[model samples]
Target: MEGLALDTIIAKAGARPAAALACASTHLRAAVAEDAVWRSFCARDLGLDAPLDPEDRPLPSFKVGKRLREDRTLTNYMDAYKVWSESFGMYPLPLVKRVKLFWSSLKGWISENFPEALRTLSKGASEAQIRSAEDDLGFKLPMPTKLLYRFCNGQLPFSRNHFEDVRMAPLGIIGGYVFYDHSVNVHLSSLEQMVEETKEFNLDLEEQGLPIGPNLALVASSWYHPKTFILNCSSGDLYVGTANLSAGEMMPCVPKSLIKPTDSDMPQDGLLLWLEEHLRRLQNGMIKIRPLKTSRYICLYPEASPLCSSAVTNGVKVRASAVFAPEHPYGGHPGTYLYSYSIRLSVPEACMLGGVYFSSCQLHSRHWIIRCKDTVVSDVNGEGVIGKFPLLLPGQDEFVYESCTPLNGSSGSVEGSFTFVPGRVTQPEGKPFNVTVAPFPLQVPDYIF
Candidate 1:
């Protein structure tokens, strides 16, 4: 009730606020395991009459008033239950998919409309065979690669599959999410419909006078470096990027050298151009090869630091750019692709990414993303923010992964270990919110898997 940050509390509640607040979110089981106070509160106030609705479950005492600093306790306890249930869940709340849809749509519209960037090939291939297609297509791809590409091409086949799964997700604070398409949009609601509204988007970027005709599908670090991404949407002729959240006209990532893949150092006598021209010829039937000129590769979305800028193979610079897309459509777990690459290729002396494709052969579950810096770790009761490794400050300790056990003889508790480093990200202001929730019983999965 008294330990979490004020900004976090305000973020969880949505909208910027002047009021100071604190909370220690926990699962019903963890709440019981935490202290006798939570158990007594539950027995006396909640589960008193019947099974609890998710939105009406009891939560730990959280102090959220700027003026009434000490009033963290609840007489009804029902408010605690409702707030916690609304904020905490084993699967996502069926609404966060908006983040996925918006991004997927961004990719879909671009790739299909701006086909000049990526070379397209057959879709729905096995994990093993995808490599060949990518090699055939000639570009690294992100998860759901074919899906995002099709969507960009104006086909929305997998749109339903991408949005329907809510099991792997956890509710967000302030529902904090940043988005882009042809326009810079901020998502503020967390509901099924608003989640669906992102897809109905068909705003003519051309109507807005954007570079909708540019056949350049690229992945750049979002103007905002909130989360890393690897994207491949065919950006319209108009190039866009975000500036820090201070709010001004969003600017394009400068040094055009930063985002686009270049062969200047490894300049291969217009190899890139040759590849493009060759692909056009292949499509137009002007030329033919015994097999083809295609390849599967990964796109690294590195930080904008100079260290990231100097990526090379055999001392020759390769393409590298800004951080990952804030809302990557191909699922945001950059590690899966990185780890998979580890199995196939040697680590680059200095590797950074812009985006990747044709890396994995199987269709990925884009719902539960791999752990990222902004991952959120909140308890069922909405009390404390769990801390984790590398995120710790000069002298901070790790919050070991703890169990979520039932309290007061309740039916069950939501539980899992998530890492949080207070000063590590969103710096000088906000921090990353990486969280992992156990939707099913951990014991069952541990032994079964």
Candidate 2:
């Protein structure tokens, strides 16, 4: 037969049959070993555009080099890739590819901006490790979650043993917000970490005489903060622990409808979906990285327009936004909701208020009108903010401060104005005037980041 005819025949016969036929004759072996023939087979079977393994290593031949799934080299680190790739064989190819794309996108962003944080990501865990966790926890992990770890194990927990270590704490991929003494930065837990935390969580519940469900597993938590995320391994839903968690109450992080698979034959889980949605927000600039203290971390607060409100009055501009802090849910008050708002004030140019040119301004006081629905809840006047009066300089960096409040209901709005003098608070250059702080919405997000 012609070479083209022979290559086509071997391709259709599949890898095993072609390998067997290749041994029959030298010509048959040459045709079967052709790179073009094997490449087509690899693409058909594995959805691969290039000949690479799970670790992204180049393969020798598509016929014998069937990625890490069948390559099976038994090293401590490579074993995890083998097991993960094998487990992924059962899922639909499209879903498997999508799961990879999600992690890749997030990792790409981290590598570009926070390369040190990206280096902290652990290698995939072995099947034995995952099984050990399941044995210890007494529950099987959801398939989607299993694949998630298979791509990359959870981030390594930072050691905040010294003052300098405090800088690394905010490197968590699932970052959080800060309000006063309350600080949170959430990161995914490794299988080993999950086993230990779940055990400890159940123990605490047992001590308090609270019911401990066999299906609940602590999968993610803040590095040093009290916040934690729990996964129901059986049902595949994810939740964040609230301030009332010791009393056995938590809030769902993902929407219920999203947890359900579009096809009944295929199974879905919340942790996977949650991370995918988070990546979407990051790429869309809904939530972004912001500086906190001395380090920069992913801030859950919205940065774009609408969700964040901005206005200018008297040549002084104020931009403000709020984020729902689920970890501090209700602040021990079951009926209340907690929100953290960040206010940034700046004078982009020289202040030209009241036809008088001024070089700077100092904040004197603040007036806030908080509302739940349409009813006014709290009207207050206070001196300075967080006990500091920030001075705004012409063409200088904005002065930013974050504070929180507890609302009586789910939905509310905060509108306020700040009193500022044209110069130092001690030496006034002009009469104090109000700077507009536009109203911003406060509501529980449908999809919690």
Candidate 3:
């Protein structure tokens, strides 16, 4: 029995029958043992193209697939995969694959970096649960978002009262940044939470005499932080709550063009695109997990170059980056957009400027030229940043400070220089010289958290 002959027999008789035949005949067993034969069985039976586990790690042999059927634990995993794939069958195969990949990647990252947070992930929501949420919200969710929930229902439940407690609040999957007292860690809402939050928001709007729409749902948010993401089921757009949320104002999270339906016969939405792009950024190292006081969250601030600016002047190294702070309504100013920026300055080695060798530098004052597109908006001249003079000495840790700026427009750039004295502010070693703060964009991102 040749391999091709065995494949033909297996295709006709199926795996169980073929296995029985292999047990009876040595030649047939030899042919059935071929990797290709079991590989075909894996695809036909398990819908797996490669000999790999759920985490995408390789399996020893394709024939190990038979165990997945008999083992109860593995059976549950396979059943979930089948159910999820079947649920989104109307979508393009590539898209279904992409969605699975995103969850797998996210889980892998969380397991390695923050395993405790991994426990927070709930199992996939059932069809009945999803339908219940849809009925409660009085609208159907988009196909992409439906498929998303089918993979994982969202994070675990938490009491509203304990959401702000540092010891109790679970680390959010969509990590946030910290600058002083402000904190934001965003998490996806489960089907139950979605209905509740949406209803609560609608009630608030009604109390304020604002119109309530049936198509809206609260999909994600940062507890104790003002940031909230709302989904418009009819339009397939996801929006971030603006300062005027009570007045029914919002900003689109995904570009309109990117949220259209694909050839998969399924409509793509902002939630799906936003998450995929976010995953891409995480996997590519554009952003990273950051530690807070007693916990950690995913920091939105871009750490890579271009998005993050770095420059060295007279041996004074400065690095700066910024993140959109939608939660910060900026003193109730509806038109203004808020962004938090972090600036780090260090003097790792001694420097010489204008024939003066100095071992250290002390921040004196600062100048910032803020622009929106080509037009200058604010030229700020201030004393010490955040009111403290940072002394930079060789081999010492970098002096870091985070401050925010408001933008009237959606896009802008910040570029300026810092005046530094060669020694401590109390005792100057040389005349003050300028250190550059390289230009970095303060523009809105396509994927809003």
Arrange candidates by lDDT, highest first: which order? 2, 3, 1
lDDT of model 1, residue 447: 6
Candidate 2 Cα errors over 4 Å, as ranges: 1-49, 61-87, 158-167, 261-266, 354-357
Tens-digit per-residue lDDT, 358-402, candidate 1: 111111111222222233322333223222122222222211122
Q: What is the TM-score of each candidate against the true structure?
A: 0.18, 0.84, 0.80
lDDT of 2 at 290: 83
Count of residue pairs whose backbone atoms collide, per candidate? 55, 0, 2
Better of 1 and 3 by lDDT: 3
Clashes of 1: 55
* RMSD, candidate 3, Å: 5.5
- What does candidate 3's lDDT look like per residue over 19-83, in tens digits? 67779878877776667776776566545687665445565666633444544555322322333
Count of backbone collisions in candidate 3: 2
Candidate 2 lDDT:
0.79
Reference-based lDDT, each prediction: 0.25, 0.79, 0.78
Considering every candidate listed, which one attains the maximal lDDT? Answer: 2
